[model samples]
Target: MTLKHLIGLVRALTVFVLMVGLASAANAVEKNYTVQSPDGVTIAVQEGGNPDGRPIVFIHGLLGSRLNWEEQTSSPQLQQYRLITYDLRGHGQSGKPDEVEAYRDGRRWADDLAVVLKASDAKKPVVVGWSLGGVVLSNYLAAYGDAMIGGIVYVDGVIELNAALIAPHPEVYAGLASDDLKTHLDAVRTFIALCFQTQPDPAIFERLLSNAAMASWVMTKTVPSMTVAVADSLPKTKVPVLLLYGGKDNLVMTGPSIARAQELNPSLQSKIYPDSGHAPFLEEAPRFNQDLSDFRNSIQARK
Candidate 1:
């Protein structure tokens, strides 16, 4: 072939390769959808990663939305798994019913999760819950059982919230109940600070403060009563459980909680991030992601 013709062919091949790469990148982009709960509340859902891969649903804590899982969703380690996140009712973009009864009923939380799972078409998926989300997950298992879930991961979550268990964190309840906006915000800020062993990024701290400020007061007041004895459910759970906690977590007493969980379910596996606090997933993303990936792989192997 002539030299000019060879050069032209090479250019064409490069253009074709570039176009394909761009197309693949576009295809990998995450997709968002709106899922409606049985009670008519709308949940904003985001799905990404391998479409046909094992589903992993992440439920964020009180005053937290699907955005809380940005690190996990964007991590290359989880790109091979189907990742799902959604705003819990009364948080984020989801509808907030003004009635106290809405947030007080534990069934509502479970039902909302059921709808999200059904909408996502997640079959026997691995469910990960953080903080209040842990309570929600327990409520779900109580109401729906483990038929639809293959595994559970609790990240600095509450297993029980009886007066004794909650007594140590008066600041948390005080922050939630404060009538003065400044008092409430300040308390919330303190609570956030307590969640980390080290100071968080300024932007992240600001964002968390903003999100906490948006939480409905009624929901805050009602959540304490909504919790059931999740430890009771452990005896019946046959699925693998990974309890991830922050050793420095002043919010949730990790030792007692983990001890109680292991006592109830001997098969339960756990790991503590000694350098981290309440939100270990955020405080130690690399290690947390690796643990999550390992947990996911173990579950997949059993399946």
Candidate 2:
């Protein structure tokens, strides 16, 4: 009832409220939604982390969905930032168009990304594209330019599908495109295995396998022949670009990929994980998260 006692209680209550708010933000569950791409295909999008914090949009590779970014979405180091992820058109919970034409143009993939950004109302977020997701980034740049985005991180990205950059995997590609369920499933397993120098955790691999299985067969058959605009688009990107490659990658030739990318955009910055294979983000997640945070911080500092 005394003045000093009432002041002390108020101070304690304020501290308690602040702590609760922080906890809630840290524990916020990822929110999922579906946004229609320009062509009317529904793309499944997920958002988490501090809603008010700087945003980072994660684009997964072929046969992957938002689920591929679990290493990033659940990262404690990145909790201070907004995390956004989505499934590519024919993958995961997104609508899968049976028409081969739907997956042929690279620009449609780019437009899908734009749709996700518009739907989320993200303000110039940094985009991280992995593996096949790199194709999406190039198309996006060709279509939208860099004015709408702050920066980008290319994680073990596929710069060009040319022989010099893409490792020889005729057997795998052939099997994947096959209509035989047994052969297709076997190829999927082989392809995922080739993603890492060391094997992934059994549980994680299983989860990824399940996601890959859910992908549309039509996409697998059509996307290989899709046009890549990296040569045209990458040369024109004005935003900060970071390239992360795994030296031991079997799916993509790391050295050649980086060289081709840098040749296209001389402003690109890069890092290599000698021990990792195709998926450095998962093989070295702790390091990847810190590096990403640092990249975001550097961009913020410049602004």
Candidate 3:
């Protein structure tokens, strides 16, 4: 072969090898593992991004699984941070104990998180919670405190659930209580649609509905009574907190809750997406991902 042809061949082979290595790295991030909670429940977990990067743990809402954070996980900006997501007990592929006692009280929820952190070997990671996941994080703080986490992120979540604190969404809660499966599914469908400000992508919407339908109705009904108000716990939290919410959210009122959280903990910071609904992370993913990256950086800078 001519010298010029040989040089070109070498360059092409080098490029191909680089591309293969990159693809393998990306595939590595998609691996899934299982961790056993203290209560013996098996939690399904997925980890991705830079192995040496700052750890960020994601907790999904009620009836939602680790799949709920797919957008964030796939974001290029977040690729530099180690991301961990787990299917909470009673949802997704995680263990579902048929007994009401398993769902009652937030101790199991808190303990599940601890087990996931330990199993993943993540230390002082930032914990991000959405919807009911937010409540679960609050329950974690109430039970275990913030010593194990670098920061906390609340995405349209409530620290306290009381009639006097916020208006009731009878229709939303009623859907969970419905006896008929069809009636319950229909209510859940409406509730899911209301969660988005603009029409969601068809595939994502369907996947969300499918996942939501998988949750045990009995466990769903028991969660409210099981979760105690974390209002008092907020004042004691020492880690920095970032609260992200949608201005048009119809499910949980963000203004009062944000104000109350800020009142309780001055270390809290927030961003409101005016045009979005309950799921700001999914609705405005690019912006949400950037905000989260910035928050993580700020926390690291402080250290």
Candidate 4:
């Protein structure tokens, strides 16, 4: 290989080493807080990184919590931003309200985020959502519109959830029913395997799956409405959107979904990790982090 090629290889290795080191040190850093929603449900949240930086709120998918984005919250990328990851109403450490109304649409989720942002005194943050977290961020934009956020990053998020349009299946329900966290982790691994089309770090898969098992039971019950409501409102949103997908993602990261998302918001910027699947953030952390940083920088440049 030429010297130029060698230099590029060295840079890549340096980034990889830096990321691995950050991952190793991440587990020990943790903080917990709670935010009360409009309806009185107290949402659970976890935070890390530079508290003085620009606020970047993270929302996890169905059966996920702030822990889902643990690595991202811990990484050096966060040095430029204050990271906020939260458990939606019935998931993770958040209050699990029994009524479906409590979880319906993305309004309450957005409200919970607003409460958290207000508490943090982080104005107009860049909201990042994974899975249903994407829907929540979009709905936040829909309700409060662009006035509430600087930008949005959707990490293998549900661009829209209409089964009739996207084809839902029993695996979705089966995934939610996994009582053993290990089994849930396995299922997510299987799911990720199908989506990533490439090998992923087995340990990250395990950690996320464990979080899924702990936070997911309630998602099965509420997903139907979350899908319908978010779909109905997506097309009207005009805020800047960044969409990232795992090429191997079997759930919602398909071509049609990407196309539909773009159609809904013509300005939506998208990136695909050909080797990744549903959980791109974990499955391909380094690439995902770089892409996210680039997207954020691009937005900053525009401003």
Clashing pairs in 3: none
Model 1 global lDDT (CA atoms, 0 to 1): 0.84
Error of 4 at 150 (Å): 0.5
- Ranking according to TM-score, highest score first: 2, 3, 1, 4
lDDT of each: 0.84, 0.91, 0.85, 0.70
TM-score-better candidate, 1 vs 4: 1
Question: How large is the C-alpha RMSD of every model relative to the true structure?
Answer: 2.4, 3.1, 2.3, 8.0
lDDT of 3 at 256: 86
Model 3 gets an lDDT of 0.85
> In model 3, what lDDT does residue 251 have?
73
lDDT of 1 at 116: 90
Q: Which 10-residue window of candidate 2 scores lowest in summed lDDT? A: 22-31
Taking all chains together, each candidate's TM-score versus the true structure is 0.91, 0.93, 0.92, 0.78
Residues 91-153 of candidate 1 have per-residue lDDT tens digits of 888888888888888878898999999988997888999988888888898888899898999
> Looking at candidate 1, what is the lDDT of residue 28?
55
Q: Please tell me which predicted candidate would have the highest TM-score against the true structure.
A: 2
> Residue 247's C-alpha lDDT in candidate 2?
87
Tell me the tens digit of each residue's lDDT in model 4 across 121-196.
7666777888778777767766665766777888877766666334354674575456766655555656544534
Q: Write the per-residue lDDT of candidate 2 for residues 144-262, one digit (tens) a residue.
A: 88888999999999887688888999999999999999999999999999998988999999998999999999999999888888877889988899999998999999998998999
